[model samples]
Target: MRFFALWNPFVFVGYDIASKQQIKETVRELYSSKPHLTATIGFSFAGLSAALSGAVWTGAVATLIVLACMMFRVWMEHHFRARSSEDVGEKWVRLFVFGSLLSGFGWGLSGALLLYGTSAETQAITMGIACAILQGAAGRAYMTPGTALINISLVIGQMSIGAFAEGNYIYVPAFLLYFTFLASFIQQMVDNRLRQLNAEQTAERLFREITEKNELLRIANERLATKAYEDPLTGLANRRKFDLALAESLAASNDTGSTISLMMIDVDHFKAFNDTYGHQSGDECLQLIARAIGSSLAGRDSLVARYGGEEFVVIVRGEAPDMAIAIAERICLAVRLTSLDSLPSAPPRQTISIGLVSSRAGTPETREAMLAAADAALYKAKKGGRNRVCVHRGPCPGQQQEQDTVVPFDAAKQA
Candidate 1:
């Protein structure tokens, strides 16, 4: 008897925890598919079980009390659902108090009945079942300091009844000791699991936030790299990218016995046009030339760039002076066709003068040397007259003289 009293609280606490876990899982599964039907069946089963158990062992009074408690629980569930907007903690607290009150009253009445007329075994069975069912359903409510007081009151009432009938007051202290240790163990386990679940949820949320931030940083880096290496106005490779490409093309030319050709293009009288029309119209003219030049070069080894101001550069691989000259002529013709009426000047249109230079593999000239030679030819074109293509013919009198007389184009005025 002493052993039974000592261990009963622990056993009851373990059963209560297991039962609550099962009920939570079951409710989740049922709610996912058939919430209304599942809840209705669950309440009906609980009410029926409590009623039958009470009637079989105790009496009509115990059965009535169990039925009334079940009905009150159903009503409280409805109230909670209706006030779904209320704070969940507050709602559960209210439900817990309500459940404890019902349990205390039911047990108190049973204890009295046992002390006056019923047997010890019957009283214990009825009280245990009633406590187990009520605790399983209302465990969330007892998440407060008040639960300890309620539980103490219950243990005292049960012990007093058992002691009064048997004349062995030792049962009172024995049951209290057993119940305290058992309830403490069960509460610790439940609390540990809840803490673990909370930690897992927090970790998942933090991981998702970190992933989103990394993706945003990746996109931002891509945009920065593109802006750094690309020309914003003409949507072409900028001068920096052009310089890198020229170096690579020169290296490849040396390795593969390929020739590299460079073309330097200057929009004819661009400054006069910009002054005549406005900065906006000048920008439109530059955009039109960029489009025409880009359209003229369609090979993988050819690249066009907004070299500087109104000047553009084209690099072509595996092409000789004649082929490079032909491509320059094609671009010149294409620009002539692109109507520049947006320019303040009317009709007979705007044109570009191009200078072409070709360097065969193993040539003594570097990429910068080739570009200087092309610029010299471009100067000769401007000197002779604008709007024509000039091919560099290696250190000729005209090419050297122009290289000496070359003047830098005014970037701001070139528009």
Candidate 2:
């Protein structure tokens, strides 16, 4: 068990670093291999030109041999690509080194062999050297640093030494300047590659951070939304959320032509209970009653909410009047039987009055109307003596009032 826990396959084991290294090496080989063919073709053109420009046919045959060597290297590269990915890195490096050495030596030999202290020989050698340097720098852009540097040196070094021996003072300085230019260009490419790599790393880090922050923000927003509608004391839907839900329910019922039901429950003599037992006990009692009410009305479609003080509300759909009344009776019985033995000395036997009202939609009935109907039923239960259930149809008992108290609407039915 301990070993399995430590090496859990469902969790965070990884080879992240090795995976990135493999990716980098594969890309490096790919880039380096592609440029080799282009470089080989450029050097071959220069080789053929130098040999054909000479008076002796020996330079021509030598250039043909060099071209053949370059062609063989290109064919080898094509075959290299057919190997498996794991084998590519080593084989690619070996091929790059061989190709560089072969092409470098070929150009260098042509420069030495073709030069004869004549004006035409000087011109031919100069053209070949210039072409070699330019093509090397441009076409070998993706080669390894060591290979590029060595190849450039070999191609120009022998020719430069041979040019000065012909007694042209300017040739030595010119060769030195050309080598200096090549060195500077190589250094620039290295610097650019380094800078690009740094920039890419920084961008990757920033993107990861931004993604993490966005995910955190999404989770935080979800928490805020849940809290916004929940009552802190009972962990039930608060009055504000209840109102919104009731309105939406009413609208949906109206559209679907279904009956929308609501039950408004008030603890019997709640004010007197709170006056005798302090507000804290009253709050605890309400929480217990709310929980009982919720459990009694358990289903996916019904919603139970704390409707301020000791008043609780329930909204349900897809129920006839019989089903709705049965649920309300269950809530009343549950509240009556709820255990209060754990708390301090208080009302051991408590009861609740539930006012039930349901509206067959498409009657232009508003949420306020449904609530007024439920409140009216609740009033009848309180007036006719508490601990009972009252159901209201669509009629207002507006004129019959007890002193300053308002009469509830829809006071036609009681259970």
Candidate 3:
């Protein structure tokens, strides 16, 4: 019962029913195999052998028929092979069916012409060759089972005509029984092939889905990381990331005996500005100042971040005190140049006070000390009438003035 079920002609195994695409793809597979080519070459060789054995006319004619069938098969392959499975139409499939039947007819004629009315040994050889061709047809049944059936039946039926004419009563029932077995075998081959194709397609679909999901997961992680360390309004590094960077820089400066500068920048009179021009304008003003400060330090290797409300910080590595002061001066100038036309009843311009602190080689350093010194310098800058750069290191050598380290804003620019 199990054996019958496995090879049952009416039983279509695998998925509920094959999709149209799968059926078309199976039809396309028909063009992928070239069993007929091998059959053509083998018959040609056998024809030549027969001619050498003194059956000249029979051998020559058989060779011609085999060559013609080979040409038909080649033409069918060339015509349809370039078309994709999606492009395969019903008419194209019917044309292929016709070609298979014609080729089978040619092979049957060639076999009958060569082996009919021969000795018992020759008759047995003919039957053996016919059975081999039938098996080849069965193997390809998965590609186009209906076409295979037509080709197999036509080939055997044509050859059987000669066997019946020769009064070979024994060969008839033997051929019929063999045909039934082959029919069952062809059905089983088709079921197995369909199952295999389904498995491959399912695996491919799963691979694609997994790849897409992984890409989406990677993008989500990137977004989460950005929100964790980025200031939303100003697009600068937030205080959390700023503290981490400042600590790392201070540690490297202490270890390598190098210098690093810290600048604490505060928007001057921001509370008064917010009172005069609503909080909406205040936020816009801060955003503009942030961009101006970023532009001032564009060419320098520094990390500019939002320290807190109305204040920002910058970290510059490997710079001397003078260079650090100059950078602070640039920030003062850049913020003073920010346009205020957008704010209602806005002042002529906006300004920011920057405090510069540099930790040189041999200085006992810590992030806390650096932050405190920078904050003290910023307080002095704001108290010294604002819009200036003040250094925490008191006075320069040979300077007599109390505010020697303070870079006062250019009064000439106010004119």
Candidate 4:
């Protein structure tokens, strides 16, 4: 019974009967892609072989007939396209059976008519080729057992008839052995159909799971990358990001023969503000200062980053002497305007002391040198009193020069 079930081409062995409609749909979809192309090539090759074998007029007629049938099937599909899926499916099943019947008849006719009275060599060559073509049809038509079995009956059955009718002693045994091969071939096709369907389902499930996992991993990596380069407190670029941006800007400035500036900004008397107002209030002060500085450089190609406790760095491209001083003044003004009176004893207004340095295109200075120069200017601002902007130009020298300029705004004067 197992062998019989395995060898039976008549049984439509697919998914369970409960999923009959789904099976039909799957089979139809599979057939839709390759049938027309297969028909055209198969018929053309058969017709050409006949024509070369000196049956020009008959071959032409046969080729035209095959082409007309193929075109008719194409028309059949389009005609039933807008109907309900159930109706379309029924039509597809019927159309496929009819197509198989037509092609099978063509091959059976080739065997019945062409093999009559031919020599043993001609018969072998003719029927052998026909059997090979029928094997291919079996594979292509296996989605519907009725279609494949009908095609197999017509084409292979005709060849069997031809083999015995020739009455050559060797011909009958030759066909019997060939028939055994045919049984094995049909068994394989039936088994392969089930295997292929199962494999497709497994692949789809695995693919869906893999896609979900990949998306989650992509989100995790993005979060890790963001936290690495961002300051947690003020929501600005961290010092590491600041250093990278400064390096890139310096390289660009060198290529364009322009100046790129780095400004070191420190909250004036920040330690005193924290001591009097508490560390919580001091954090609020830093956040407000960062917002002000970011707002000051909003329209320019500038980067402002949190550079450690109560310190910030700003990188700007172009001439820095005038621009840096102006940006620093704007930052000081923006911070001073913010009202952060969380406690009674807090200072009336917060101010930042900024030291700015311009990296000239020809200057022999690195990013660290620019920071050091800006730091020197910041120290000068602290020495000359707080609430000020100072500019330091030229190379990164060890000593504070007399050419550095300071714009001091006294807390008493602002009040």
lDDT of each: 0.62, 0.66, 0.76, 0.68
List the candidates ranked by TM-score, beginning with the highest: 2, 3, 4, 1
Per-residue lDDT of candidate 2, residues 291-398 (tens digit): 888899787379888888788889988798678888888788888888887667756767888788877545546777777778888888888777888888654234
Among all windows of 10 consecutive residues in model 2, the one with the lowest summed lDDT is 6-15
Candidate 1 regions with alpha-carbon error over 4 angstroms:
1-182, 318-321, 342-348, 394-415
lDDT of 4 by residue, 1-415 (tens): 1335543333455644325666657555634625644555555565565567775654566567656656665665555454565553455555555665776666665554445454444455566666666666656544554556566667666666755675544655665676567656666766677777677777878999999999999999998888888999999999889888988887777677787878888988889888888888888888888888898888888888999999999888775567666777778778878778764455577888888888765654577777778899888877878677777754576535445444554433543
Residue range 147-214, candidate 1, lDDT tens digits = 43354456356546755665756656765665565456445545555565556657878998999999
- The TM-score, computed over Cα atoms with residue i paired to residue i, of candidate 3 is 0.70
TM-score of each: 0.53, 0.76, 0.70, 0.68
Off by over 4 Å in 4: 1-93, 106-130, 139-145, 156-183, 193-219, 341-347, 393-395, 399-415
What's model 1's TM-score?
0.53
Regions more than 4 Å wrong, model 3: 1-102, 173-177, 180-206, 247-260, 271-281, 317-323, 339-341, 344-350, 359-369, 393-415
TM-score of 2: 0.76
Cand. 2 Cα-lDDT: 0.66
Residue pairs clashing, model 1:
6-178, 10-182
